[model samples]
Target: VLTRDEAQTRAQLLDVRRYTIDLDLTTGDETFDSRTVIRFTVRADQDVTDTFVELKPAELRSVTLDGQPLDPETLDENRLPLKNLTAGDHELRVDAAMRYSHTGEGMHRFTDPTDGETYVYTQLFMDDVQRVFAAFDQPDLKAVFELSVKAPDGWTVLANGITEHTDGVWKAAPTPLISTYLVAVAAGPWHSVRTEHRGLPFGIHCRRSLAPYLDADADEILDVTRACYDRYHEKFEEPYPFDSYDQAFVPEFNAGAMENPGLVTFRDEFVYRSAVTDTERQTRAMVIAHEMAHMWFGDLVTLKWWDDIWLNESFAEYMGYQTLTEATRFTDTWTDFGVVRKGWGYDADQRPSTHPVAPEAVNDTASALLNFDGISYAKGASALRQLVAWLGEKDFLAGINTHFTRHRFGNATLADFIDSLAAATERDVHAWADAWLRTTGVDTLTPRVTGDNGTYTLTVERTGSRPHRIAVGLYDPDLTDEGRLTLRERLDLDIPQTDGRPIGKRPALLLLNDSDLTYAKVRFDPESFRAVRNGLSGLPEPLTRAVVWNALRDAVRDGELPPHTYLDTARAH
Candidate 1:
């Protein structure tokens, strides 16, 4: 594993210029030839003697530093030490035979069971970049990447940039400053759907076996893609950072999707081989919107270290659902996020392995990879949603645009992001970050209501320290039908109340965290609980019902409410 300390040392000493990597995939089935030439400059003021580049190869054929041959015998495990390094510019070339992987780590090769067709794609996330090619494999040491691949006659090559095939060699356009993990390659006899959206080439590819399925949904997929692309362009002042956009549905993908600069890779299952619900299609659209958002949040401006992974995922997650809701037909996207995705975050947060949304420190790469769980994506996005609620969308977007402007094509941290947010608003964003991001577990908000004559005062009792700006919904039983309730009015309230809120003439029920704008376990007041038990299904909006259901689920998990009561409520509703 590449420890954070070692990465920092290498980053301090070397400034990578660019990587020119050549892969010969026609060599064989088990292994392929990989040759990488790295040009970097050592800081003149730093007296660094030696540094190492990482590569996990089947056979280390040769290595040369500054055109001087180095013994291949010196290769150690995943690291090849470049001894006697001097300051100023130097070039390092490595020639090796890299093995293909079946476990979806490095270069994963998958053979279709039905037709004996072959497909391969790189899942070079985290330290897996070494499994394909060699370089300073860290997020902070961003560099330009140029790739040339020699594949079989019928294969198509997809990469981080526009790829052109000429004279049997496919060469990709040089990428902007990006982390090594974002370097992607998927080569196969793909079924491709191509189009032009807003003068940029947009393509989607899948394996031959999934051609018909891919074709069936290609128009819908492209529609969502175009919608998201346009929406992101509007939200982010930074124009599309890359030359084109391509989404490849590759086989045996480990994660749902990877945000490679111009090429985003999704698991081929998204092509849909069977029937799916509208909600499922909406989920797919959300994923499309999510990955497109990464084109700016993750690819354009990356995280400095693994600890700040939330900077990439959380931003994308929030932007994905929000953008999908605003720009596409998937207007009820957050309802799915709240009903389906939010539980993942709450569960992970309560686990023994739970970490803060942004941990103070991730000691090594191994520790960092584990942090990609629900907290990083779901909880972090929820925090951002809450931030937007409190800070207001206009100021929040201003901070985001400022963030992109300040660190375009670079890396940033949580503190840096908070600084960006603080610059755009008068609110104490730093305090919010400390309270929401630096903490673990969920906060409980139990409503306390008291009435005098016809007027009622409401107070929220919080169990945790994080501040939340939430909505309280008031509902009244309909005069025509008691079982059907109508929304009275929604009240916005902030945690740690400064003054008592006297809401004149209380309604039949009081629901906290009404719109699901914040991340907290909300509890209904006694009257509201009774109303929910009788008419929970009367909540007009799916998001409102999701909030109520989630509260009951949390109560059951915490043993505050019996499992049978939850089940009974579900049965009745």
Candidate 2:
């Protein structure tokens, strides 16, 4: 495994200019032929240095630096050393027989059981890029990649840029400056549905066996894609960075989806072989929105290292749900996020393995990979959503646009992001980053209420250091309907109250974090708790209901509310 220090050392020493990779997939089923020519320049001030390229090849065929031959036997583990390199432009060429993956890591090969047709795509996140092509495999050493593939007679190849097939080879358009992990390729006899959206070619692909399924829902899939694209453009000042947009539903994909510039790959289950619910369809749309956001957040402006991966994922996750709500028919995506996704974050945060949303340091790649857990995606996004609630969307978006404009097609860190937000608003964003991003575990907010029938005071007691701007829902039983509840008023409150505020004429239930705009675990006042036990299902919005249920769940987990009580409450509601 490559360490962070090693990646940093290599990144500072060399500026990778471009990579020309040729993949021959016609050779056999077990392995494919990979030839990579890397053109780079060592820093002018640096002395003669020895650096290495990474490739996990089955057989090392040949290696050359400049025009000189190097022993293929010198390959150690995944690294091939380029020894005694001076400070100037150099081209290193590596030819190898790379094994195909069944584990869905690198160059994953799958044969559909339905048709006995084969397909292969790359899932090269982080270190897995070495499994496909040899290069300086770090996020900071951005480079233009030109890929050419020789595949089976009828197979179609997809890549980071537009692909064109002529004669016997498929050549992709050169990509913009991007990390090795972002370079993608999928080749198979695919059933494709193609269209033109805003002068750009948009397409979806799947294996021949799933052609009918792809065709059945092609219109809906495309509709979501186009809606998300338009919505993202409306939010971002920067237009779409890549040339074409292609989403390929490949089989045996390890991740829900990967944001690979122009060609995003999803697990083929999203193609839907069987029946699915409307919520499930909404989830597919959310995933589409998520990956598209990455075209701007992760692909366009990338993180400098793995430690700030939340900059990629958290933004995408938040933007995914938010955009899906705004632009698509799925208007209650955040309700789903609150009910399902937020639980993942809360549970992970409570674990012994929990780490900060953006930890102080990730010493190596192995540790960095571990950070991709719930904290990065769910908790990190919750923090961002909270930031938006506090910072206000106008200023939040301004900061985002400024961040993009400052670091477009380049690398940035957590500090850089905070500085951008600081520029957009006068609020203490750096302090917020310290309290939220640099901290682990969820904060617990328990409400305390006092006073009489028509007059009351509400106090929110926080058990953690993070500041929150949350909504307090005041619900009353409907005058006519016995089981229904009416929204009396929704009060906005900042945590760590100066004093118990006079909340005149408190309703039957007082729910905290009613809008699901924050990350903290909230609790109800005694009256609110009693009301929730009786009328939780009567909450007007799904989001409010989700918040109330989550509070009850936390109460049960903390032993404040008995398991049987929760079950009985669930049954009663």
For each candidate, what is the lDDT? 0.91, 0.92
Candidate achieving the largest lDDT: 2
- lDDT by residue for model 2 over 204-283, one digit each (tens)? 99999889999999999999999999999999999999999999999988989999999999998999989999999999
Q: Candidate 1, residues 1-573: lDDT per residue as tens digits?
A: 988899888888989989999999998899999999999999998775888899899999999999899988888888888987878999999999999999999999999997988999998888899999998999999999999999988889999888999877999999999999999999989999999998999999999988999999999999999998888888779899899899999888888999888989998889999999998899888889999998888888898888888778999999999999999998988999998889999999999989999899899999988888889999999999999999999999999999999999999888888999899999999988889988899999998888779899998899999999999988999888769888889999999899778888877888999999999999887788999999999878889999999999999999999999999999999
TM-score (C-alpha, index-matched) for candidate 2: 0.99
RMSD value for candidate 1? 1.0
Q: What is the C-alpha RMSD of each candidate to the true structure, in Å?
A: 1.0, 1.0
- Candidate 2: lDDT over CA atoms? 0.92
Off-target runs (Cα >4 Å) in candidate 1 are: none
lDDT of 1: 0.91
Provide backbone clash counts, one per model.
0, 0
